[model samples]
Target: MIALPFLKSAPPPLQGERLYLRPPQLSDYKAWATLRAQSRDFLVPWEPLWAVDDLERSAFRHRIRHYDEEAAAGTAYPFFLFRNTDSRLIGGITLGNIRRGVGQNGMIGYWVGEPFAGQGYMYEALRLIIPYAFTKLRLHRLEAACIPSNERSIRLLEKAGFQKEGLLRSYLKINGMWQNHLLFSLIEDDRWR
Candidate 1:
């Protein structure tokens, strides 16, 4: 694949009090799979339908390749969130839709493991990723989309300084159906504006 406009870019490693962001690795498959499976009930309403044996090694290998390709191309960084003390994979997040030049913008997407939820891991992940976007990628804006009913995610984004812009009606087919989202964003200037 051709490189993204921000081809020189790469995801910066980020760390926080309880969480860290790192490139996803093959070793993470088992932990990631188990998290997803265990969180199925907790994640289904926010994600797609459970695919057939998606946790299998073959599928995971494909995903690893995809993550590597996207990260190398600077189109996205499929990162794993880890609990700092034990360095255990607790979730996945990505910075995508990178636009360079004047816009210098990107979007953040993430999912936290069920057991890790409500413990502020997602919030810490956002805290780390947003700064990485602004400083390392030199991004001017960062965006996030969350289902209106996803109170936890909404709170996390808001806590990270993203302001709700508006609602996108039936904007995406999440969980196999059209879903509305509350669009939120933070601009670089907003940091000190």
Candidate 2:
């Protein structure tokens, strides 16, 4: 559970013009469950198959504990995306699988509610998080993976300065099937050399 000395503390809420990213809370279950339920069809194709009780409050409580432990261990930071205009929950994102020392790398994963998708909310969130990844988290590289058919996510990563790296065959089990994924990465400026 060792981590770089700098990231010993948990990060604060990251604020953007329209949204703010903060750690998930138990109280967020209702809003989060509602959004996920409403966006089930929209999200399932890109995500792992949901368990039978995926949207249940008890499951969400477990998630909150995992998030807390990961954050405390400096291994990952999970965030619930909330719209500032109405303070409504819109989505979530995480910087997970963090590696420190010489690597200083991590993986980014995210999803937006259906009604909030297609717009630039995720893009803005990415813009905000990437810098935080490099600065606050002191990471040198950030990676993301998406299925080949997910053009929107690929485009979003490209827009956020991630370079297409290569393809990973049967990289992850998604939506009840093993899916190939395209890898993309961004490296911090001074570390690029």
Candidate 3:
């Protein structure tokens, strides 16, 4: 059995030039809900089935608690992306399903608000998270999967140095249905050299 790593505390916020990545907090419910509501149509196709009360404040609080627990257990690290200047919640990113023994790997997932899409915000966030995953989390490989048609996401991952690995048939349920995804990966040794 794989033993979970432990972290004494939550990771500190990752700061960037124009954006910052931090775990969701109780105080962020309003902004998170608002952005999600507005971007529902834009984001649904790439995500899982949303619960009826997914945007409710109570639900968000529950999510925060769950994320905190996951982080402390070193099973996952989830972050909300925000604009540094105005502190607006723009999107979210997560490094999940961490495996440490043989693989030392984790998977990454992310989404941007409709208005924030195509503006390079997510790319900058990736730059921050990649290093943290390798240097701080000590992960050796980072993987990402996106629907084959998500050209924008493919481009972003490529820009961030993830190589297209292959196609995953019926890999995940997206928008309530099974979907194929293109796999991409980056290794720690290839990160800086």
lDDT for each residue of candidate 2 in 26-136, tens digit (9 for 90 to 100):
999999999999999999999999999999999999999988888888899998899999989999999999987789899999999999998889988888888899887
- The regions of model 2 sitting more than 4 angstroms off are 1-6, 190-193
Preferred candidate (TM-score higher): 1 or 3? 3
CA lDDT, every model vs. true structure? 0.83, 0.91, 0.92
Q: Report the candidate with higher lDDT, 1 versus 3.
A: 3
Q: Rank the candidates by TM-score, best first.
A: 3, 2, 1
TM-score of each: 0.91, 0.94, 0.95
The candidate scoring highest on lDDT is 3
Candidate 3 on 64-115: residue-level lDDT in tens?
A: 9999888888888999999999999999999999877889999999999999
Worst 10 residues of 3 by lDDT: 1-10
Alpha-carbon runs more than 4 Å astray in model 1: 1-12
Candidate 2 lDDT score at position 41: 100
Q: Kindly give the stretch of ten consecutive residues in candidate 2 with the minimal lDDT sum.
A: 1-10
